[model samples]
Target: MTTVRPLSCPHCGGKEFSFPDKGRCRCLACRSEFLLDETPKPSPARPSGGAGPRRLAALCFLLLLLAGLLYALAPAPAPQPASQPARQRAATPAVTYELQQLALAADPTRDGAPLVLRVRGGLGQKGPAGYVADCYDPRTQAWSEETQRLQDAVGKNAREIRFQAMSDGSLFLVLDKSRLFSFDFAARQWVDARPLLERQPRLAGGVVQIEIGYANEGDALRVMTADGTRRYFYPAVDLAPTYDELRRMVADYRHPQAERRHGFTFARKGAGTSGPQQLIRYAFLDNKTGPRLFGGYLEWDGEGQARHVKRHAHIFRQAHLEATDFFTPDRVYYRASVAWADKEDLIISFRPTPHPDAPSLLQSLDPEDGAIRWTLQCNFDGELVKTADGFYLLQGAKLFRISEGRRPLAEPQRLF
Candidate 1:
């Protein structure tokens, strides 16, 4: 590209001019000349001034050649800024469900506030696939049998169940030889959903176990098995079943046949044992690695591919081994010598049997080694209310703060 600028003669006021090579400009008026020597000049003569004309001519020619070469090599006009490539986005944080409230009322056992249990069971009688869920409220405390009937409780067909409640309110329910069904508490209806392992996943040695965890987002669920395979579930969207591949899963909920096993003992004040809201058998892993988890059913069905799911394993990772024999709903005083160890390992002992009975004996693990570091044995009179500090154990018509630990917590004067 070239640019032109007008040249005028100062003396004669002539407007006409012609541009020449090498920075030179000529004006017709007064015959004025400007920058007529942009071209390279010959190097100064040697100090001795003895160089021949032929030698000087050769030097001048080389200088001119070098100047032409330099001009030719000048950079081309700055190129248009190269189109910037699109930036990649960071991944979303994992989903998690945290506690919103533990509503308490005069008769929590009567629905104003109810205890929450995350469980796993079958969808219908002998529904082939077992599933898991937060089995809403108890039928006894429910509004009425008719209303309760409207609710979708885990049917009898479910043969196996496994559950874990994370620090965040996220609840994981795993089942086997069955599938899951989701309930819309507000709608009093069952949401149409599919089973995650509808085809059931099989594992080596023909053993399988299922486990679930909720990430920090609370939007998705992570599923894991004894075999190290993982899957994720997004509750917000519908899942495409055609994209799923049914893998082999644990064939039965029989603990004797399980590749891994965990046990529990649920008992109340004087009661030997009680039935659980839901029941299912499962294998347990002893460590954070190596052992595989296979077999489990979910509470609801949607996105069916387990491979595509993300398993945040650390959420339910416990540090103690729980006594697994007692699986009941009646017993309040329950002791579980679980798989992991530590105070935060979730090693707890419940007391007083189910509802109305209140908790009596309590135990927790040591945060350091998951050892049974604390225990509470109480003889009280009425109902009970619990908090991190202690529990208000009620027996008969009397209410008392039944506490046992390093420093006994002071009993509050009154509780409405």
Candidate 2:
């Protein structure tokens, strides 16, 4: 193929044109400057630095996005082991125990006051330097007016070790020890309060008593905080269930049986082989409820299948509960710290405050259905005493025997 060149300048229509440079031309007759052809000239290339930052910025954004996605998809952390340093953890805010009246099932057989069981929480600035509790003597079956602080209840060392009441008339106390003298009224002499297990407590006698000393579930597994409120993972009850039982339960609930291949277990809930609220808690490590610890109560229907399952899932990253309310209600009860439950009365923590005089809210429920029979405002100062015949709620030094019978709580018999 042959290439042909035009011999005219478009600028001035002159045939005589001269090249001023490789890219440009000029007409000699008209003195007009022009390019060799009508093709547009290319502009100078921009510096690489000009666009480098924008590309770099885009790359950075992609890396950041990837990092965020990885973080979101990560598995939830497991329950922290006891050995991990908690330097990064925020302090657990102190919870004020507003228990002005503590139910003392000191002696149900005798009943004036229940049994005299006195418990005191550490008064962090408001009153006391320690936590202490006492029970009526089993020998005399009487509430001792004087309560001596157990060695375990001193300073802040054992402040968080809570006292729990059992369905049995017997009280359960746990501690390494601040010792107590057991007087045998039948023998009229002081006896050794021994043969006591350091952690596992049982209602051995009519009155709640134990040898004084905090028997650490394991070697002082934790450093005692100044306020004695630091929590540690105690030895768990060896209740890991068998795989066959769990499969049966999961099948009963009508969910995918293959789902049981993952981690799961079930445990019975009740006290000393008694109560209408008996249940089996089916716990599984599921992220469906946001991981952490999620499970439910396996309530069986008349057809022997799990019809209603009550769930228990919460972020317990800070502290472990040594004890919880005895009764689990159908709905949420905000900060429901259950104190005690008997044949007639059920005590729930009212609110947190500094005053010792503020009583906890006590509700009497029908033993048959757990419906609220009545509600009474009572203190948990550990002054509610049980005698051979009735119960009494003590505020300060004054004794107000709890009005008995089926009257509404507002009409609680004003027994002196």
Candidate 3:
């Protein structure tokens, strides 16, 4: 009945529609029915031109400003520490050693150079099976292997082996009680000592023990038999002496008569002569207790003139001197081993019998005054060796060079 504005479907916003009823219309594009009044109408034009674009720009600037404020207020992620390279660790050194039985051989040909004998084999093995002898020179700090094999001559069931250096630059290897082998340095081989052993009359009896000592002439070997007889044989000569005969000979030549003085009896234990000076070590026993009371030494001139007798009363109380040696009657004995370090000092090694837990000690004493110069804690059973180079202590598989200075006992240098 009047001019009608254009109408579109509300569901699909399409201008194309069909009137299904007077008030309802159906969209041809979406095929949805809707009331004619529910259709959307076009928007009217605004008076403010381009205001929406400026408002959108202002909203974007506000969002950026808010984000900047949040970044400033929040703690800036803690500056990550600059990455660094890792540090490396250091390296350690290596130490090497071997467990074995070692013995010292003093070679006169090498000017008292220490020759160590190292026995390599199983402890339970009979005789010399898998046995080898390795030599160590302490002066040079070097090791040398022996080329000769010792299995055949050294014998089975050998418990101990020892080397005795002779005056003629030769060596004697004593293999327990089984056999003896002489080492010829020139030929570099082991020579069976049977021929020399046959030269002694006492060889008919089984040899029980052997000892080496310095006689007036040269190096002498003392052989003991199971029948409680001892015979001294000179390796350089065919002459041998019986125990009693040798005792008489030694008493007449080297030893002085036992003397009683100051309520003690003094018997010579050792003696040495150097040119015009002579020194004699004596074991002084108490007249009543019969135990050794102290250490005594006699100093005299070559003209048979006697010097003052020096008595070391403190020596009896030292740990090296057994308490039994001082207290027990008729049990007077010296467990300490003594060696002459030089013309002036005597080196003594001993362990205290009373304090069995105490360490063994090496003490140097002035023979003239009996004053202790210094003391070193070491193995009492270690062999105290005197060479032209200096004094050495051979204990087990280790060798220590002893210092002769007056300074307090410093750690000894281990040569091996």
lDDT of 3: 0.55
Q: What lDDT score goes with residue 27 in model 2?
A: 81
lDDT of 2 by residue, 358-394 (tens): 4455555443355676566654454444444444555
RMSD over all Cα atoms, model 2:
28.6
True-vs-predicted CA distance for residue 377, candidate 1, Å: 1.8
User: What is the C-alpha lDDT profile of model 1 across 363-402, one tens digit per residue?
Assistant: 5444333345556554333334343433444333233444
The TM-score measured for candidate 3 stands at 0.47
lDDT against the true structure, per candidate, is: 0.35, 0.39, 0.55
Q: Estimate each model's TM-score.
A: 0.24, 0.30, 0.47
Q: After superposition, how far is residue 284 of candidate 1 from its true place, in Å?
A: 25
Cα lDDT tens digits for candidate 3, 107-207: 66665665666655433334334445556777678877543455533334545666666534567766554557786544445678857867666565556
